[model samples]
Target: MSLSTEHLLGIKYLNKQDIDLIFKTADHFKAVINRPIKKVPSLRDITIANLFFENSTRTKLSFELAEKRLSADVINFSASQSSVKKGETLIDTVNNILAMKVDIVVMRHPNVGAGVFLSKHVDAKIINAGDGTHEHPTQALLDSYSIREKLGSVKGKKIVIVGDVLHSRVALSNIFALQLQGAKVKVCGPTTLIPKHITSLGVEVETNLKKALEWCDVANVLRVQNERMAINYFPSTREYTQLFGINQEILDNLGKKIVIMHPGPINRGVEITSDVADSDQSIILNQVENGVAVRMAVIYLLAQQIKR
Candidate 1:
């Protein structure tokens, strides 16, 4: 069995079966990575290109590592160093890269629908590493995979995504992915940072941090995207931290242990206090490890389509 869709452009494009299939594939890869010899010849004959129009550390490295683990030849592209700086078109850059006989293209771009647009114009299989504030499909998949690993299953779990939802591709992807797996989802942040019509996505909005934490089995804290914000969403960083930050004290008061997760480059005391982030309850490290295995599964499965 394989993914229902051709391109992993967004979680919104995937159905429950596709998600399950990816998880099942990831289960195999997870075991492989744990073994003495982590490398696999699964995509030995395939070539992949990693194109980033925006700066990235975690996502870019995860995809590169995944591709290498599967023994796929890899090419890394940065927009800043390329003709894109000279105002070259997206299609021209991709077409030039495709000339190298690449089988798959993993890309992160600053514009929403960049992946979708590329898919239409390019022959190589497309994977959206991230596309502006639209979606990060692999991140959401690994997130749900982590939840399932920690809690046995994603179904019936209450997940509250905390902070900066308006500027987050992760939030949107996670919302769709979690809901698809039958988990209850919520968005928590300042009203300015939270999209006004997010309720239309069937997620409840909770502005109060303690209340949101009290209601959730897992709190996936997001980074405050100061880079994306053109204006102040809140008065000050100190104020935001005081009101919304997750701390050890807040967890202790809850009476029940709730899993803490952060998609990294954490803002430390801003979205989450250091004590809470480094505490035993934080699966932040696990999330990072699972990212590689889950990404390997995605690349492997997508490569299978190329073989077929």
Candidate 2:
């Protein structure tokens, strides 16, 4: 399965065929990662620009590791250290990077459509590592790959994404992915964190944790962006835990055969309890492992879209 000649600006661009291709590619790489000497020369001589405007951990490291494994030149640009802090515009910075003949730009910005903007201006291909609460294409791909590997198939899975949906690009991207792969999806969070009336996205939205738990095959917990909170979204962390945290009680209540997941740097006893995150039912670590394979597939596939 080959990649099409289109920019991976969002998961919304992926149809069933594209999904299958990336998944297949990821499956190929999973074997590659398991080998003793993990290096792929597929992308030899390619230079990738890691343009991140937002603070990150998992996403950043995953991409760097992916590129290095593929034998690609990796240059990381942080907004705080760059001319963007010295009042340089996004376009000017992108043009400066492009002038160096980059092959692609893996970007994560604080605003929605930041990746789209770079895709429009840069000659290189654009891979959306993340763009605010808008989309995180690689993340969505890794998630889909994780589900496919673990469940054998994502079809007919009742996947529930819980916590901070309104400010979560992961939630938005994952919603598109799960629905595309034929999983039933519902988003659950407190009214303040979940926002109002987003059920129109072909998924149910709920505010009650117990009710959502009763109705899911996989329970996905999201991290709280305490740094990005705008207002008093929730009363307190204690109150949030009482209402939404995934403790041992919630895990037992969900019964067996329920898979748990969190996009990492998990707030441990916060959005999810230690038991659930460390449980046999938890696929959280799989998500991180697959993140590298998925990112490699994304960079390899997206780079092929460019005609040199």
Candidate 3:
């Protein structure tokens, strides 16, 4: 079975079957990556271009690694160093790349709908690495995959996405993906940081961290995006930490082990403490490992649609 949509622009575009297919595909790739000979020749004839209009560490490296693991020829582009600096349009840049016969475009951009826009105009397949504060589909896929790995399944799991709801692409994607797979989701943070229309997506809002933790079987903590904040959403960093940060003390008070997750570049003390992040309950590292396999599955499946 294949994904319903050709381009993975967002989780909102995917159905339950599509998600299941990705997870099933990832299970196979996960085992393949664990083997001594990690490389595969699945896409040896195909070429993929990674276009990053924004800065990334994990997502960028993860995609590059996934592409190489599948034996796809990879081209990496950074907007900061490219002609985008000289005011080149997105289409011109991509059209130029497509001229070189790139089969799939995995892109991360600061603008929302960048992937969707390219998919309409470009000949190649599209994968949205991230698009503004809109969505990060693969990240969400890997996140749900990690949850399933730890908890047996994503169905009926209670998940709380804590911190910076307004600015996080991860939070939005996770909400859509998790709900599609039968998990109940909640957003926990300061009222100002939480989007006003988020509850319309069928997720509840919890302002109190402790109560949110009590209600959730898993907490997917998000970092405080100071760079994305235009104004003071809360009084101060210390205040936000005091109210929303997850520490060992808070986990101990919960009386049950709730799985901890953080999509990386974590603020050590602002969103989660180092001890909690390093604890056995935290699957942050597993999420990173699963990221590679999940990405390989995505690229491999999309590459199947390419007519060689």
Candidate 4:
């Protein structure tokens, strides 16, 4: 099955078939990346522009490496150093880049619906790296990919997402992707940080960390998004950590092996401890390693739709 859309705006826009196709494609790229010489000429003649309107380290580096592996001509753009700093509109900045003969546009913007908005006006294919509190489609895709790699299949697995759900693009995207692939999902966090309507997405909610950890096949930990919080949701960092933090003690108490995941820029002692993050049960590094292949699958599949 082929992707039904040209742009990957969000997981909300994808179906089970689309996800399966991406996974199947990613499997091949994963093998390719493992070889000594990892470059592929699938997108040899294509040009890609990565426009990040927000600060990023992992996502930016991951996409660039993925594009390079696929042999696509890549141009990187940061909003801080661009015409956006001079009051130029998003559309104008993108159009100027596209005029340079770019074939695909991958962007992470501070505004929600930024990818969707650009897809309406731009001629090139749009990939949503991320958007504000909206969705991070590729991250979710790689996450599922990592889970499948570790556990053999995503269907029927129990997964719990912990921390900052209301403000996390990763949580929203993962919920959609996991549920689509038949994984049971749960969100655990402080009441204020967990959205009231999160259950509408067909996932259970839990405030107790111990219960959530015991009930899941995997616990996907998230960092506290201090940048997104306009006002104090939870009282203090110490209180939040004491209440919800995952450490060696918590894992040892569980008495069974369950996968641990964290989308990075981890808060060492806050959300997760250094020991747990580096433990045998942790697939945190695997998630980062799989990101390139998953992104390559997204870019390669979309490039198939772009006429050379």
lDDT of 1 by residue, 1-308 (tens): 87888888999999999999999999999999999999998898999999999999899999999999999999999999999889989999999999999999999999999999999998999999999988999999999999999999999999999999999999999999999999999999999999988999999999999999999999999999999988999999999988889999999999999999998889888999999999989999999999999999998888888754
TM-score of 2: 0.96
lDDT of each: 0.94, 0.85, 0.95, 0.94
Write one digit per residue (lDDT tens) for candidate 3, span 40-71. Answer: 99999999999998889999999999999999
Clashes of 1: 0
Per-residue lDDT of 108-173 in model 4, one digit per residue for the tens? 998899999999998989999999999999999999999999999999999999999988999999
Q: Which ranges in model 4 have alpha carbons more than 4 Å from their true place?
A: none
Per-candidate TM-score against the hidden true structure: 0.99, 0.96, 0.99, 0.99
Residue 194 in model 3: lDDT: 96
Query: In model 3, how many backbone clashes occur?
Result: 0
lDDT of 3 at 72: 94
- All-Cα superposition RMSD per candidate: 0.8, 1.3, 0.6, 0.7
Q: Deviation in angstroms for 81 in model 1?
A: 1.0
Best by lDDT: 3
Candidate 3 Cα deviation (angstroms), residue 48: 0.5
